[model samples]
Target: MNEDITRQLREAAEAHRPDRAQMLARVERGMAGPAVRHRARPFARSGTRVALAGLAAAGVLATGGLAVAAIVAAPSPSPSATVTTPATPSPAVSSPRPTSPRPTPVAPAPATTLGSSRPTPPTTSPSPSAGESQNGPLWSAGSLDSRSTIYWTQSNLALKTTQPLTSLTIEIRIVQTGAVKNTGTWQTLPSDDFTVTVQEADGALVYRWVLKPGRTVPAAGFEFAAQFNNGTAVRSAAGDGYRVDAQGSGGSASVRGGFVPTR
Candidate 1:
């Protein structure tokens, strides 16, 4: 019995055994198919991941070292630039200068002349048709003549107004002459022997006589002087009273008489 069973098993194994070449061809085909390729993708992906993690770690270390070197080597900012320092102002100075003085203007004095201070007095001219003197007397008849007469006991002398007259005045002066060493000297009598009349007429005035008594003429002769004003006429009998002898005894005693108009 055992021998029959063994022969039957061998025939079955031989009949069921697989082909190596055919099995290998099928494995290659499966690998080439979607299912088998999908199962193997995890191994390829795991290898790529490890390589990328290594590269990233190297980049991190290099970047960190460069940053540290820049931090250490860079120059510090200057205090002037960072802190903003303020500017300083400059000081101011002043200077003084000298000045010159201006000149003052002078004014000129006024002109003057000599001998111009005093003024001249005025004079009047007399009328020519009146038959009067061209140069009038300096004083009036009343100023030059007297109204009183003197008297003496030895002779009676008189001055008389013998007619009516207007604006009349008379002046009389007595003179005496004597022989001394044969040289005749004539002198006016003293004021006691003279008479003066000063009269002004409203219309006319008349007088009969006025007398003066005097001593007789001695060895010395005598002379008389008479003057009258305007519009006066005396009596012919009184003419002797106005006259003095022009020729005296032996020419020793002489007289000169005349009429002079008042101014």
Candidate 2:
């Protein structure tokens, strides 16, 4: 049995033995086939490259769409910046305003006349009847009736001076039968019992004394005489010393009196 098995293996080896030339030819064909396949591989790889390029193009388009969408969705600037731009011009338009015109100047009316409206009547001179005698130790001029009773007198005397004096001293003598029986002294004429109007007439002060009900006057058979005491003389408007005119019984009798300066 061992001999039979050895013989079969020897036969199979001899039958399967390759020819050297044929073996070489077969290896050469196999090498040429790989060279042809290697030459055609570039065409297959070109299709794969086209598919990768399409995928890359799709990725790029998606990225660009995302960028555009982000730009459209973003918010604008704040409202404060828009408000501040218009506020800058508001103060500029309100700065200049129109000025109003000043009122026209007016002149005052001319000065009107002073004091009472009624015109002052001219002073009348007194006329004395005959048989009337007026005498005094200090008498300068004038005559009084010795027999005429019921006499009334009025006098408006004015005194002009360079200096201002507060008051005057006047001496009144009561004469009866050509003798001074009683004497009275007064600081101001007309006293407080009479209505005396004192005013400036023609730039000189004039005192108006009316012998009304309450004034002093002599009774029947007596005469009233008056003169300035010492240091009472003043200048007159006629550029002379002080002078006075007295009218009695409603201009029925009158007397002119003069003042003699003491110093």
Per-model TM-score on C-alpha atoms: 0.18, 0.27
Residue range 1-263, candidate 1, lDDT tens digits = 97676555545444443444664565466357464344448878787577556545545544544554454456766677476667766665656666667767666422111111121111121122211211111111111112211210001112222221222222322222111011111113343433333232332221112113442232232222222222122211122112222121233221123222223
- Whole-model lDDT values for every prediction: 0.29, 0.33
- TM-score quality measure for candidate 2: 0.27
Cα distance off (Å), candidate 2, residue 86: 15
Separate clash counts for every candidate: 6, 0
- Alpha carbon lDDT of residue 106, candidate 2? 80
Mind giving the per-residue lDDT tens digits that candidate 2 earns over 1-263?
A: 97686555545444443344664564466456544455448877787577557645544554544554444445655577444444444444565667878878787532111211222211221233211224221122223212111221111122222222222222222212221111111223335644444443453333334455534443222122322111122212122122323333333222234322211
Q: In the order shown, what is each candidate's alpha-carbon RMSD?
A: 39.4, 27.7
RMSD of candidate 1 to true structure, Å:
39.4
| Superposed model 1: Cα runs more than 4 Å off | 1-41, 81-263
Error of 2 at 145 (Å): 31
